[model samples]
Target: MSVIWKGVFPAVTTKFNDNDEMDFAAFDKNIEAQLEAGAKGIIIGGSLGEASVLSDTEKIELLKQTVKTVNKRAYVILNIAEQTTKAALLCAENALKYGADGLMMLPPLRYLADKHETLEYFAAVAKSTPLPIMIYNNPYDYKIEVTLDMFEELSKYENIQAVKESTRDVSNVTRMINKFGDRFKLMTGVDTLALESIFMGAHGWVAGLVDAFPRETVAIFNLAKQGRHEEALKIYRWFLPVLELDIHPKLVQYIKLAETQTGLGTENVRAPRLPLVGEERTRILAIIDNAIANRPELPAGSWGVEA
Candidate 1:
């Protein structure tokens, strides 16, 4: 089935063992938690998944393994952060062969292409693949903004179905809605801003913390979408401190640690990106521990459970 472009889509972390090999068992466990918690889709090999460090062959293997694990229970979307258009197209094409349900793609990796170049890059990729695509519009990390005007140009592509709205400007959600009005499904990419964006009009969340706190993450989206803001806010308030971790430079390590605490995975990261240590590690531990100790009791409803 094609992606509906709605609900929680966890940008899952890539699991690596002590020998620096892909741990498919651990990876499938995390994906299972997300699906059990009602995740609509799974985004593999994203920034949170250490996309920068993963080889293309590794990414394809991850997608293939995830497809085997999911068995069509939820959409399996591969993230493409390639530095060049050709590489991006190749990634998308490989995703197609592995039965990938969709894609969450970033702008050109290291290059800050101008509007025309950026638009053309997206068009070229979108034109190459038949899969539905969600433009990962995160300016803070990538340095290139996918402006509304550029989106206006991108809107012509039938396959460009959504935007991972990470601009952090809540008003941009409103502006996108006013300008395009459901032409694109808007899923907030920032963890802390999720409820705010949802209230404003984002269709779903491309969540980071969900990799660790799958049930809590899905509960917030479900409660809020049902117009249960007060209920969602209670959990969101308790969740704020840990959700803030997603915005940090060492987010992959931080979230992996959270996953470790939850028994979902480990903190093993690729080379050049070692595990956290010192006061920073202690400080992050305190935050994670506090959230775990004082974890909010989820209110009862459609998505309400501590599972």
Candidate 2:
């Protein structure tokens, strides 16, 4: 069964209650909103979702809940960010057991594995599971660049289907296409570069800000895909500032605040990751308020295409 990996797949934040436990009520509500807004899929336990702080059990339960709530309406991809090969394989097995539709995996965390080590780790995990995988290539955050040559070697694995292109270099989009052609599907992982990536033939987006502004995010992708560049630009220009929030260190706090302001979710993040406060909070709120007050009218009728 080929999973159609395309369009906006929000790297959704894991909602927690005041006691630092998973808040299913808020979580389910958020998932419903994403589906209603025409999100192609929902990704849980990603960097945006705070995967590092979550325990293994919490990660599995989150994947299970997402799979049940989404109920085949869209893809539910679990992020595999582990320290060792054994742990990564365990996460992959658990994801398959809990009915995850696919996975988005980062290379060895914190160790900065070299190219050969990275390739070996990925190949081992790919062989261990039958689920489709999207190799995340974000050197800016991970410090490990899965170079084009590394991809050439890993392309032999049939389950390694796509890449989350977060290199921050827009030109890499073209470079990947030039080298691999249609061998690997490219999905823009950076929220700010989404429109440019789509215009450059990227098939999808692993979005961050869409957790709060789903309709606008989907609109930009659809409009550009339909060749409506002027209309897409109008929305993209308005969205750039809000999208910048996703790339920051406090993205979890900032995006959750946006969700609360928009009436979609809450601002209760886990400990050590407190809610945005002080002047920083005021500054972000100002941006969200300005965008909301002057929100652009979306094009009439459905703006999304089926994957």
Candidate 3:
């Protein structure tokens, strides 16, 4: 069967109530909104969803809730990135049981792991699940680099089917496409570089900011797929700055704040992560507000449409 994960799949946000508890209702609403707004599928419990702070019970409950809410309208992917293969395997098994379309995993991050350790971790997790798996290789955030050769080597696993290449290095993507071709699905984890990736032969994009602007992100992929690069690049340039914040160390905070300002989602993130404030917060808010205010009056999927 073909992979169910192609196109604009947003790394969804996990909503919390005023009491700082998981708001099942709000989370439910957000899922429906994204699907209705034309998202191809939705990703849960990733960096955008604050997967690190959530407990195992929380992850399971959220996955169950997501299944119940989305039903079968859109693809549901569980992001189960952990430092240990044990955790990743358990999470993948549970996710598969709950009807997740696929699994996305990040590399071991607590300690610096060698190429051998990393490959073994993925192989173990791949064997643990029946579902297809996507390796989330974001070297920028983890400071752990996965060389093209290492990635090429790991793609041999039966279930290790896709790579979320977030390094934004064009050459890296080019090499992967040249070496692997259709053997492994290559998706861009960085939104700003998404168009370039498509032109270079990426299968899809795993976007964090899609929660706020589904139409824009979806347009980039759809347009480029149709060979409408001139049109796609325009929206790419417009959405670039706002999308850059998603890669920042303070990504969750800025995203939460932007959601609040847009009436899209809440700004209430769990502690150890605080709300944006002072000049930095102000600058960020202004950046988002200005984008929205100055945003062109384009129709849905207009990013792909010519002016």
Cand. 3 TM to true fold: 0.93
- lDDT, candidate 2, 1-307, per-residue tens: 3567788899999999888999999999989988987888799999989899999999988998999999999998999999999999999999899999898999999897888899999999999999999999999989999999999999999999999999999999999999999999999999989999999999999998899888888888888888888999999999999999989999999999999888778999987788888999999999998888888999864344443
State TM-scores per candidate. 0.97, 0.98, 0.93
- Give candidate 1's error at residue 299 in angstroms: 1.6
Clashes of each: 0, 0, 0
C-alpha lDDT values of all predictions: 0.91, 0.90, 0.80
- The sequence of per-residue lDDT tens digits that candidate 1 reaches over residues 1-307 is 3688889999999999999999998998999899988898899989899988998889889989999999988889999898899999999889999889999889898887999989989999999888999999989888999998999999999999999999888889999999999999999989999999999989999999999999999999999898888999999999999999999999999999999988899999999999999999999999999999998888776363321
- Model 2: which ten-residue window has the lowest total lDDT? 298-307
Expressed as tens digits, the lDDT of each residue in 172-204 for candidate 3 is 788887887787788888876777888888878
Candidate 3 or 2, higher TM-score = 2
Instruction: Pull out the clashing pairs in model 2.
Output: none
User: Which sections of candidate 2 miss by over 4 Å?
Assistant: 302-307
Error of 1 at 202 (Å): 0.8
Q: What RMSD does model 1 have?
A: 1.7
The best candidate by lDDT is 1
Q: At residue 73, what lDDT does model 3 achieve?
A: 79
Please give the lDDT score at residue 104 for candidate 1: 87
The per-residue C-alpha lDDT of model 3 at residue 264 equals: 76
